[model samples]
Structure formats: structure tokens, C-alpha cells
Target: MFDVSEVTVIAVDVFGTTVDWRSGVIDGVAAIAGHHETEFDCPALVDAWRERYLPAVGQINRGERAWANLDAVHREALDECLEVFGVAGKFGAEARERMVRAWYALPPWPDAAAGLAELRRDFVVVALSNGGFAQLTHVVKGAGLGFDAILSAENVGAYKPDRRAYVNAAKLLDAEPRTILMVAAHTWDIHGARDAGFRTTFVERPGEKGPDRPADAAETTDCDLSAVSFADLAGQLRGARKGVDAGH
Candidate 1:
């Protein structure tokens, strides 16, 4: 356990963690192609679109241009993709708009609803994601996720691994770093929170994200719990609560 002092708020990272990006992107592309009267490989397009994600964000962070929301970045990448596949002529402006709207309609992971519902029963649950406010809002509403508050890197004008983003989230919760638990599937995110003095819980959501994570050489090797799913996480939290309740 990081501190075991009775957690008050659980700040969750959206995207590949709480939600399943692989299926979401594929379905979004299928829906867009249907509305646009165009044909594109749903899997290939989903792969291509996500492949551009990191580079696009890095470009913004490098001062190559001002920051744009994930939707704009995704669209820019999609346009380039259409050009690459020699199919730019197939989509109209309206179709393109609808395609972008698809990002706002992600479906929740099967366990997300149940896990979040359980967590909300005990603590103030909020979104702590790299996505912008609009993007996160749409995702939450679309998936019917009941987050008490939505927070983003946009709020800090920076992204993860940056202390400012974590600091901003902590400020919004009006809770000390140690009093809030940061839950995510990515090691970098978990390490970021640990370095920033927050309790961390790592959830494993395999085969639905970009790449496999290498073992962290710098991790404490004793930070906190690593859960294979949200249900597993809930069990750990329940145990932690029991320990707390028992004055252990």
C-alpha cells in the first residue's frame, strides 16, 4: 500500500485504461463510413488513426504548432490517411464532420460501468485523462459514465509525465496528493502519480492498447497494488478499506 490512510477520491484515467480503444476506434470508423457512403478498412483505418496519436501530440508539445484537441488531431491524421489510401475524393465535408463526431461516441468497456458504479459508492470519482474537456465530456455522456468531475491535460496546458497535469488534477479535487488515488493501466501514468506523491493503482487491460509495456526499472517495487481488472481493483480497495476499518 502507498499510504493506506483511507482514500477520499479516486482519479481515473480515461482512454485505453477505463475504455477499450481498439473496439471503440474500429466501431467509430465503421459508423463513419456508413454515414459517409465511403468504404475504408475499419481495422486498418483504426490502426492508422491511433498510430498517429503520439506523434501528433508530440508535435504540439515540441512547439511545432499550438495545441489542438484530440478530435482535431485525429481528423488531421484521418485526412492524411485518406490521402495515403487514395480515397480523399470519396468523403465530403459533411461526411468528414460526421467521421470526427465518431470520437465522441465511444462505447464503455464491459466492466467500466460496474466498476465505476462500485467506486462511486465509496469515494468521489473523477476523470483524470489526457483528453480535452469536450472529448472527455462526450465520451462520458456517450458511455453513460457517471464521473463526479472531468479533468484533462488541457486544464494544465500540458500532458502526462508532466507534474503540472497531476498537480492540476489534485488542485481540482482540493485534496492532497496522498489523499487521492490515481488509477491507470499505463506504467508511465502510474509512475507519474507516484513521483508526484499520489497513491497509485495499476489496472491491467491487455490487447486493447498501443503496445506492451516494459517493466519499469525505476519503480519502487513496493508502491502499491497492480490489478488485472477493475473488479480486481475493487477487491483490492475493499481489502484496503477493511484494513483501514480494522485499524491495521
Candidate 2:
């Protein structure tokens, strides 16, 4: 088994890893659209909105655009998505603003709260995400999540996978990159953390993309550990601790 002896802090990716973002976004969009008494496919619109995320973030990563918070990014994408969905004329500034706020109140996955509690029994678990500080705080409060600390991209003035974000987070935690375990449901996130010198864990979240689109797959031989859920991750870490104690 891979060793966990060096892992002192667990940095978890928030959106897809800890919360059901797809469902949350859909519900939020549906609420706004339904309130307008307009009929449209909220799910399809949500998926389109999500597809725009990586490209927008990619622009920041490539230095093609200035730094913007997730709310702003979501707003820009929402506008584009509305045009594409042929509902651009329907949603005004107020309606669009409410839809953007929906991102802050996502519900946690079934294993999230409990698994986080289990991990906290042995390690410092922090919310390390691309979300803004306020957004992350609201999500933690709304979902009743337990995080010893929060390390947001906003804190470092850069988004995830960015060299600045990970570097600053490790500094803030007073932990070496090697001592921090970056756990994420997305392979791209794992690869980013690994490139930044953090050990990585790939947690499968097949439902992240919803029913039609498949979730991201881990790059071959990329992750240090693979788990089906947060509970399984806790169990593996527990086993590692037991094995270490027995060996001594």
C-alpha cells in the first residue's frame, strides 16, 4: 500500500468532491427559470454552463485574461449560456444575479460530512478549493461541513492548478507540500497538486457530470491512491495508521 506517514494535512477539493454541484446548480437554475414562468431545460442549461467553466479558467491559467472571482466568471458564463439556450432576453440583471448566488448553497454528498469527520479524527482537514472565500464559507455553513481551515484561490490571488495557489496554501498551512495530501475527484486537480509537489489521492465521483456525461477519469498511473468514496478513504488511512503502529 502507498504510505500515508508523511501526510499531515488533507486538502480537499470542494465542488464536485465534497458537494453535489451538478444537482445544486440545476435546482438553482430551475428555481429562477420557473419563477419567471418560462419553460426551458434547466438541466441542459446547467450542463452548458459547466462546460464553459474550464475554458474560462483556462484563460486565466494561460494568462490570457485578468484574474476574476468565480462569481464573476460564472456570471460571464451564465450570460453566454443564456444566449446559447435562447433565453438571454428572458433573464435580466436581477434574475442572473440570483442564479449566480445559487453556487454558494450547494448540498454535500452523502459521504462528505461523515467522511470528513472520520478524516479529522487523524489529520488536519482543510477546504482547499477554487471558490472565493465568501463562497466557500457559505458552502461550508450551508452544507454543515467540517473543515479545520479554508484555503481559497482568492487568498493567493490565483485559481487552482496555478503555481501561486498551491504554493501559498502550503505556506499558509505551515506544512511542506510533501506533507499535504491533495484529495480531489477530478484528475486535472490531482495532476495540478502533484505538479506542485503535493501527494495526491483520486476519489471517484461518477455522478459529478450528471447522467449523460461521464465523469473525468484519472490519468494512467497518476494518483498515489484511488478511492471510491470518502468513507473508503478514511478506512484506507486508518489501515495505514494501524500498519505503521504494528510495524513499530
Steric clashes per prediction: 0, 0
Q: Which window of 10 residues has the lowest lDDT sum in candidate 2?
A: 212-221
lDDT of 2 at 7: 88
Off by over 4 Å in 2: 218-221
* Candidate 2 lDDT by residue in tens digits, 115-210: 999999999999999998999999999999999999988897788777778889899999999999999998778988999999988998889999
Task: Report lDDT (Cα) of residue 178, candidate 2.
Answer: 92
CA lDDT of every candidate: 0.78, 0.90
Q: Which has the greatest TM-score?
A: 2
Q: What lDDT, from 0 to 1, does candidate 1 have?
A: 0.78
| Cα lDDT over the full model 2 | 0.90
Q: List the residue pairs that clash in candidate 2.
A: none
lDDT of 2 at 17: 94
In model 1, how large is the Cα lDDT of residue 146?
A: 82
